[model samples]
Target: MDALQGFGELGLGSRLKRISEHLMKEGQLIYDHFEIDFDPYLFPVFKLISQKDGITNTEIFNAVGLTQPAVTQSIHKLTKKGLIELIDDDSDKRRKIIHLSPKGKTLLKQLQPIWKSIDSVIKSFGMETSSSLISHLNSFEHKLKTHSFSKSVIKSLGNRHHSIQISTFQNSEAEKTAFYDLNEEWLRTFFYVEPFDEEVLSNPDKYIIDKGGHIFFTKLNGEIVGTVALMPLPKQNTFELTKMAVSPKHRGQKIGQQLMQYCLDFAKNLGLPNLILYSSRKLENAIYIYRKYGFVEIPVEPDCHYKRCDIKMEIVF
Candidate 1:
C-alpha cells in the first residue's frame, strides 16, 4: 500500500494540486518553446475575461475557479503586461469591468493553433484515462460546493429533530417579508449571504413571482414557519428548487420536509420533466430528504448564478 500510496485516502486537495502542477509544468514548456510571454496558470483568468468581457473581478474568479485575490493578482499582472484593462461601469460607479487589450487579442490569435493542439491533447488524455477529466473536475467542484469536507465529516454525529405546514407565496407584502426572513435567517446562520442571495431574497416578487416562479411557505397554526422557491427555467419545462428556509428555532419540527414535499408535488402537477436544486452537504437532513425523494446528483451548470451552489440534483419523472 505504501509503495502505491496515492494522496493517502482523502487528499483530494493534494491530488488536485499535484495534477495541476504537472499540467502547468508541461504547459510552461510549451509556452517557452513558443516564446509566449504568458504564464499558463494565468491563461484561464485571461480567457475568462475575454469571454466574459465587462464582467466584474468576482465574476472572473467564479468563472475561472480561482480565489478573489488570485484573480485580482492575475488582473494586475495582465494590466501590467498590457493584456487587459479594468474600466469602471458608467451606470454603476462602483463596478469595474474587465476587458482584453488589443495586444491580448493578438496574442490569443497567435496562440490559437497552440490552444487547438492542447485541446487535442486534453481530448486524448480523456480517452487514454477512460475519463472525462474536465467534466469530472467540474462535477467534483460542484459536489464540493454542495457539501464541504468538514461538514461531511460531522453531519451524522448527532440526531436531527423539527416539524411544521405549506403556504404559497401570495403577492402580500407580509408573505414577502416572511420569505426574506426565513431564507435570510437560514443563510446567515449556516453561511454568510452572498450578493446573489441578497438580490433574490430582496426582490422575490420582482425576480420570482413576476417571472413565473412559485414560492411555498411552511406554516404552523397559520404562522409562516419555512419557505421554498420553485424557479422556472426559460424555454424548458424545468424548475430550480431554491431559497429553502426554515426558521432556526423551528428546524427540528420537520417543516423542511413538508415544504419539500409540497414543492415536489407542485412541480409534478406542472408536469415538468424534472426539478433541480442547489444545496450543500452540510445540510445533512435536507440532502437526506432530497435523496429520499430520488434527487440524484448531477453536474452543475457552468453558468450557474449562485456561488453557494456546489451540487446540482434532479428529481425526474
Candidate 2:
C-alpha cells in the first residue's frame, strides 16, 4: 500500500502531529549550539521594534499577528529579561513606547555575525541556486505585503551575468564611457523615457569625486552592467541612494536586489540611521526591489528631481 493509504489507516493527522514534534526536536538541537532561545516569534518582535523604535504595544500586536494578551506576555518577559524597556510617551501619558534596551541592542549586534555565518553555511551548496532562493524569498515577501500571493511563478529570462564588481569610478574617459553607456540603456528600459542629456550622464564621476560619495559599479567581464551611487542627503543622520540602474539584458537576475543589499550593508556599516531613495511609479520592478529590502513608501517632497516620480522610500538601518 502507498504511504498515504497506510497513513489513512493509521490516523494521518496523528502521524503528522508526531512528525511535527520530531521536526521541532531536530530544530531545537540545531539551534542549541547558538545558545539562542529559538522562539521564532521573538525575533520578529525584535525586528519590528528595531525598524520602528518606540512603537506602541497595540501596534506591535497588529504587526506581529499576535493576540493582545500574547504580545503583553512576551513584552513582559522581554522587559524582565532586560532585553527591552517601556518608555512613556510625553505627549500622551497613556501610551507607553516600547524600545530595545542597551542589552537588546548589544544582543542584536552580536547576533549579526552568527546569522551571517549560518546564512553562508546554508548557501554553500550552489551559488546560482542560493541566489535564486534569496531572490524568490524577497519576491514572495513583496507579493505578500501587496496581497498578491502567488506560487513560485518567477520566470528567468536566460540572459544572466554571473560576475559583479564594485568599485569607485576612475577619472578616465573609458570609465566615463562605460558609465554613460550602461546608464543610457538602463534609463531607456527602466524609465521607458527619452535619454537625459549627455552632460548628466557624464557628471556622476565628477559629482561623486566632488561630493565625497562612493560610486560602485557592477561589471560583467569588463563591461558595466549595473551601477549605484550613495551620497549624503541634506538631512542629518540620513543618506540618499541614487542612480541605481541595471542593464536591460540582466533584468531578472536579481542584480538590482544585490545592489540594494550592498547599499544597505554599506549604510549599516557607516552607522547611519536611515537611507532614502526617490523612484518613479513607472518602474514597478525597482519599486518592488526597494520594498523587498524593507523600504517603506513615504510622502514625496516638491524638490525631487524627477517630476514624474511620485514614490519616495525610506529604510531605517
Tens digits of lDDT, candidate 1, 84-104: 867888988798888887656
Among all windows of 10 consecutive residues in model 1, the one with the lowest summed lDDT is 153-162
Clashing pairs in 2: none
What's the alpha carbon RMSD for model 2?
18.6
lDDT of each: 0.70, 0.62
Please identify model 2 stretches exceeding 4 Å from their true place: 1-161, 190-199, 235-237
- Mind giving the per-residue lDDT tens digits that candidate 2 earns over 98-209? 9987656655664554445434432431233324433443343333344311111111112334667766677678767766777666555334433333455678655555
Cα lDDT, model 1, residue 305: 79
State residue 81's C-alpha deviation in candidate 1, in Å. 43
